[model samples]
Target: MPASLSVETAAPLASAADRLRQIAASTVRPDLLGRIDAASRTLADATVRVVVVGQFKQGKSSLVNALVAADVCPVDDIVATAVPTEVRWGQQVSAALVTTLTEDARTIRTPIAPDQLRRLVTERSGAPGAIGTLHAEVTLPRAALAGGLVLVDTPGVGRGNARAATNLTLLPDADAIVMVSDATQELTDPELRFLQQAAALCGRVTFVLSKHDLQHQWRSIHDADREHLADADVDARIIPTSAFLHSVALRDQTPGSRERSGIDQLAAHLQGPVRADVVTQRQLAAAEEIVAVGRLLAMVAQSELDVLLDPASGGVVVHDLERAQKTAEQLTQRSARWQQTLADGVEELIADVDFDLRDRLRKVGREAERLIDSSDPGRSWEQIGAWLADSVTQAVSDNFVWAHERSLHLAGVVADHFSLDGRAALPELSLAGTDQALRAVGGLDFIGSGRLGIGKKLMIGLKGSYGGVLMFGLMTSLAGMALVNPLSLAAGLVVGTFAYRQDAQTRLDGRRAEAKAAVRRLIDEAIFQVGKEARDRSISSKRVLREHFVGVGESFKQSLAESVRLAKRGADMPKPERQLRVERLTADLAELRALCEQAASFSTAHASVALRSAS
Candidate 1:
């Protein structure tokens, strides 16, 4: 069965979402409506992302091809995947290249030949000045992808530091991850750390031991991997697989071949349990949101009923209304404590970030000086320059990531201070554009030595020799000796050598100063660029939270006013009219209560069905 059973299940989910929106609109609860709309899209699309990740040459691409039952991902031993490739369902095989260079660029669906896919996705294929592709998207008709299952083949880890960082970035967005490892070795330290992180970011993870046919001790490796995972307190399933065996079995039509390959079992697990769980989780989330909105509606209706039925309740209700209105007014004021806290916190954060950046650059400067002093700058300037550039870039990237994370943490703290509901959603904090800023800062230039020219060195040496000869010859002449004496000759040689050494030391000091100045310039540029971005993000967060709370305050005030108005109107009516009005209100509340019950029941029933299917 398709994971979501879209045809059978989508209608009810959509209907419930729409009904919630309608209720929200009628009640003037735009916040509730927005939440429903977001949940509705998740239920409608039902995308389950299963990312395939592993070390270099572990047959990750081949495994992806086999799982999808199509050769969508390019597999090569020489050059690994430089960009991620996503495989999804389509009526025909098609491909497109996605680049992160421009926002307005359209993705032209081009017909890519099977042989050319490797070229398009690999970094070695791009022209000297051409833009690199971020990732590739390929779609083909496959039963495994029928239920909106998207399989992403990511770049191999351990290939490069940047590649590993990119892979880590992908984890937060993955619904499930399939980590591939070779049977030849137990999990490496980096791979184990990755698994631990994946377990944290994504709730569902599976380990695949690939190339089982290549190793005779595949089972031992698998058992060792399981033990390692258990020691790390990460619960995950480890399945041994051989792409070669699976392909040969299919081609030869051998009996029990599919079972031996383990591809069939893997496919069954993905298409059945994994798919069902994703769908059920989304369904439950949407159902719960609907129930929350329903409860809000019920609460409002009951308040009105209470006000209309009890004569003495009017004074109490009016007093509560006045108090709520005051609270709402305070939320919009500049003097609000949460607003003040946010402003002060952001200011302090900016100062701290600036100080930290300067301190890092100072350390880099000290290290660069030591390196320059240890060797002749002219002899090893190129290597030292390259090392400095790489180190600076890494430092800048790390700082930017830290700033991004801190900004998010600060936003949460601000939200808490405002007493925002736990379920309130915030926009995704993205530092995607920071890479461009880093690039703009460019690499460090080689700070050449300020040593004197050969002519100047000779002049300085000559001057020192003349001074020594003059002084020694005068002293020797007083002792009744000639001006051109052995004592003057020896003294001239010693003085000239000392002068040359001193000149060289001065040049070295100048070069070190220049290098330190260059490093400082780079750090300053990074701070200007990255710090600007951080400040903008913090300000934007503050604005968003302010507006969200303001909306909440307004909604509360409106609800309270509506209750008070109904109460006042009912009290002014004649006895018979008041009774009729009460009866109508009662009926309306009953209808709303029933709808709320139905929404909850629908959610419960679907959850049970999903659980049964998963089992």
Candidate 2:
């Protein structure tokens, strides 16, 4: 179950926002009005998405069902999930299947009964219309989901499975990922690798050991899994759960059973710590917006106050504002240093990202060839193939993470160029779309069958032995009395054994070489495909940053121009009217000060909360 922001936390932020909103309305200042309104709307509409992913038949769907206390995601023993299902809060229970038709390739979403979910989201034998289903959306009126906690149940990761690639696409948007595994065993190497990758991508990962009731040694396994996490340096909390126990607890109203199930603790942790992070981030963002608006508001009020207090000073104030206005207006100009910094940074970033990806893929190729040389690919080809795919996936993911970080760094550099005071809020860069960019690249295709069948091996052995027998046995027969004598037969037999061994070695060598070539091809293809998409995304990011900062600059210019107008107008008023205007300005400044204090206070409270949680 997902947790919503606590009422205690939400109340104060909402109160501060309401105050800010009233001020926006009263001031009728366009800059303050729009920023406040947008911040408030973003806060109200914020949702935290927690995506659950795991290997096949790991009870991922069951865990989701238990959390929501509803069968929103279909589960079965044999068939596994083939599509992602999103479970979020709704007033009524409803489900829809999203699919794309083959002919027109147009996406169509159709409403379906909850019971139809099992058929619609499963493999092969699924319902007729579920053929091209992309994903399923399920909504319920569960209290756990009411707080904007969206639970996405994704297809499991499995060997040579297309679902693994599909699951990778969801990593970008996930606020958190719950990697589910059953209590039957500790985390496997692949699962541990995935946890590392998930942590890198989403920054928040929770490992859940499910089916706790069935495994007597699950507790021991849980401890072992913790050790594995420590060894891998993957910071994730592993919770052991029993969906069976959860279901029973729900039916029997047994608190003890629920407690033992660990579901309650899982829910609390998500709602408390996990949900707190999301809320805190939003709180701080809204606060920043509110504080910025406050500053702008106070600026307007202060300029008018100066004009109202001293008519002689009004001209000086307006002149200063006009100068500031010119600088701000230049921020939006094409020749601005920030724009130049952004353009240069983007080009540099693109080159670095391309180089980084190529370097990574080259390493993957080398590792692939090394593995091929180390083992007989004929017997280990499938494992090698899976490893290659996973390795490439990892390399690509790491590259994307690096690119995302660099993009943020570039934004900061641009911000530094724009900020006169060396402090400016870097607008959020839209770098999460790299997942979509990678999604365009296909998974590695399986290379040649390394297995040379017994028949072919025997044939090669016989072909090689035919010449060996004639040469060795004839030479031996010359030393003996007859061609079919014991010495001749022994010579042929020994030669045949030698021929089989040599032929087998030759075949193994050929397969290894073939495997190496295929792996290199795959790596090259990945680099080309992934590199192009990454550059495209980089260009897109550049455009977004350019537009965003330009807008910010324009806003600043507008605010300054308006402030100048207010000061000039105030200077022309009569003495009595000037006094009244000063009083009004004084009151607005006081309100703005209070709002800013509230923002600071909220940040302090959350900071303390975070510290305590960490401790």
Best by TM-score: 2
Residue-level lDDT tens digits of model 1 in 415-464: 56434222343345544434444455666666665556889989988877
Candidate 1 regions off by >4 Å? 1-19, 28-31, 100-116, 127-133, 157-169, 192-200, 223-235, 255-257, 344-412, 417-434, 437-558, 564-581, 588-615
**What lDDT, from 0 to 1, does candidate 2 have?**
0.78
lDDT of 1: 0.70
lDDT of each residue in 140-164, candidate 2, tens digit only: 9999898788999987876545335
Indicate the worst ten consecutive residues by lDDT in candidate 2: 124-133
- lDDT of each candidate versus the true structure: 0.70, 0.78
The 10-residue segment of model 1 with minimum total lDDT is 125-134
Error of 2 at 148 (Å): 3.8
Look at candidate 2 and give me any clashing residue pairs: none
Residue 606's lDDT within candidate 1 is 72
